[model samples]
Target: MTINDIAARAGVSISAVSFALNGRKGVSDQTRARVLQVADEMGWAPSSAARSLAEAKTETFGLVLARDPHNLGVESFYMRFFAGLELEMSIRGYGLLLQVVPSVEAELAKLAKWRNSRSVDGIILVDLHVEDPRVALATQPGALPTVVVGDPSLAGGLTSVWTDDAESMRSAVRYLADLGHRRIARVAGLAALAHTSIRDAAFADETRALGIHGELVRTDYTPQQGAECTRAALTGAEPPTALIYDNDVMAMAGLTVAHELGLDVPGDLSMIAWDDSVLCEHTLPSLTALSHDVVAFGSHVARRLFAVVDGAEPGAFLDSTPSLRVRGSTGPLRG
Candidate 1:
């Protein structure tokens, strides 16, 4: 229904109805409440196009993933994260525009187009790189309000939401070392991502400090690559007594590779996975993992982007440090 009907039923002028409906100042609170109630009873709904035109806002946010879309189907982390984002955005009467591109260049192009076309009010950037061009683009004068989901250092002055991945990596390595694993290997994700680099350094430093022989193999965070890396590491001469995987899918794959090679869980090999999920709990041996509230982390990022959209200064927010959850998949290293 129209505001004219609401004004007539509420016994208020059309200007007063306009003020109350649009949250402008020219109406009393009691009158505004009455007008709103009457509008609701009359089945009044604001036209999205008109509202957007009046406010000069699209009321939408954007996110671009520069990775294989197939990986998102099996990766529980992104699913939970998206759920959290949707939760926050829906409550705020906002929409999310998501794009999955095969390369960083394509992702940048999409972001540029969104900004130029005014398709979204803000942006949430993920999978940050060490020398990310996106950071520069987001920092340009008159750029859209952007929040980076990565370490503060990688954000380049943009508002950022991050977990302590480096510290978590060190904790995982120390836990394995404490269990008498002198030879350890980590099946890492892509080498270019900023968090991956941070984790790699932490793994190397922690293992060296503990006098452990640490090996690292990089993959694309896919099950196929994970399986391949696992087979190669497990079949090498003097195989590691313990292994750490960057994500749960990789760890699960490694477990299968261990079984194929006649290795026993925590008996001949111990393992740890990052970003724990239901799959980790249901695995035959129940994987030990680095666990954090990924859904909450995503919600926190959305909140920061909203704050930035509301004219807040750029800053960093630390979500959490992933803690280790021990399970049947990891234990004292056996002889």
Candidate 2:
């Protein structure tokens, strides 16, 4: 219904009706309440387009993924994360504008376009790099409000929500060491991602400090790469007694590789996967994992972005450190 109808029924001036409807300062509280009640009675609803134009807000948030689209299907992390993000967005009657690009340059271009057009109220930045140019762009004057999902050090003054990847890596390494795994190997995700490097450093430091042999193999977070890495590590002259995978898909691939090689899980080689999921539990030998609430992590990032959009000072938030969950895939070393 039109504001004119509300003004006529409420016996108020059209301007008074406008002020009350928009919560502007011109109307008295009593008039505002009467106007609102009458409008509700008449089933009046604000036009989203008109409200957006009046407020200079699109009422939408943007997310850009610079990765292979195929990976999105198998990776449960992003699916769960999106579910959490949607949970927050739906409560506020907002929408998420998502775009997947092949490279960081394309992602940067898309962000610039969104900023120039005022198409989104804010943006969520993910998969942060060690020397991310996006951080510089995001910090520039007039850039869109941003919440980075990465280590604070890499966020470059933006509000950030990060998990303690380094500490989690150390904990996982120590867990395997305590189980008499003297030689261990890790199949890691992209080396360029900031979190991967942090985990790598922690893995190396913890393994050395404990006098354990540590090996690292880099992958693209794909099942194929995971299987290849697992095969190579297992075939080496001094194969590791324990292995860690960067993602559940990779860990599952490693399990298949172990089976192919006729190796008994937790008996011949111990294994642990990161980002625990339902797949981990249903495996032939249930997979041990470094588990955390990834969906909650996404929700926290959305909250931080909303805070930034509301003009709060940029800040860093630690979501949680992933804790080890022992299962059938890991055990004390037996030769």
Candidate 3:
């Protein structure tokens, strides 16, 4: 039911019902209780849109992501990340307005709505690219308080929450290298993504530092493309003895390819995946992966955004560095 129904049931003015439903001041405590009781009895709820109009802030943080929302089901990283974000939001009595946009253009338009309409107090951005438009828009004074999830370069004047992909990548690579792996290759996600570039650079640097040859194959973040890239890598005359994947989905797909090629994992080739997920632990042979609290990572960004919403300094929160968690997906290289 709607607010009007609740007001009628409670024999109160629509404004009174509105204030009560929002836990806003103006109505007496007893009147608020009466309105709430009527709302509960009638199964009525106030509209977030209405609340946005009444109160300048929506009491929500907008999360703008460029990935397929449906992919969230299989990606365990998001599960933890969202939980952490929610944990912080819940404690602060704020809510999350999550939206999946098709492109950066659409995302910007959506953010504009939230800003002009005051539908959110602040925003958290994910999937940054080099010279992204979001960075440019966020630089404007008195724009929506923003926190970016990746790459400080694109963060511009906005607050950022980043992971130490360079150090973590070096550690993961060194883990395999120390295990005697050589001729390494990496399965990279969308080349345009900032994190992909970071991992690519780190992988190349670590390999060169260790004096081993390294190569990278870029693909969209999909299992099918991962399988195709895996086949190409495994079928080469001089195949790499180990592969480091940017995400667990691709690593699982690569593992399937390895089985098809009759190459025993770690016996013939080693594998290490970044951003540990449940798939890493459940996969046959269990992937050796660079693991970190990515969910906590996301939550940290959310809290920083909340701080900005509360009038904290802009661009005050900055980088995060992810640590390594070793598992079974990698092993010593064998000729």
lDDT of 2 by residue, 1-335 (tens): 44545767998765577678777897999999999899888877678325433333466899999998877787899879988998888887778899999999999999999877768888899999987988888999868889999999999999999999999999999999988999999999999889999999999999999999999999999999999999999999999999999999999999999999999998999999999999999997999999999888888888888777665789999998999999999998666
Candidate closest to the true structure, highest lDDT: 2
Query: What TM-score goes with each of the models?
Result: 0.85, 0.86, 0.81
Clashing pairs in 2: none
lDDT by residue for model 1 over 190-218, one digit each (tens)?
Answer: 99999999999999999999888999999
Ranking of predictions according to lDDT? 2, 1, 3
Model 3 steric clash pairs: 81-295, 164-321, 164-322, 287-329, 288-329
Q: Rank the candidates by TM-score, best first.
A: 2, 1, 3
lDDT of 3: 0.78
lDDT of 1: 0.87
Give stretches of model 2 more than 4 Å off. Answer: 1-56
User: What does the lDDT read for residue 331 in candidate 3?
Assistant: 76
Compared with the true structure, the alpha-carbon lDDT of candidate 2 equals: 0.88
Error of 3 at 130 (Å): 0.7
Worst 10 residues of 1 by lDDT: 48-57
Q: Whole-model Cα lDDT per candidate?
A: 0.87, 0.88, 0.78
Against the true structure, candidate 3 reaches a TM-score of 0.81
**lDDT for each residue of candidate 3 in 227-287, tens digit (9 for 90 to 100):** 8998999898888889888888888999999989999987898888777777889988898
Off by over 4 Å in 1: 1-56
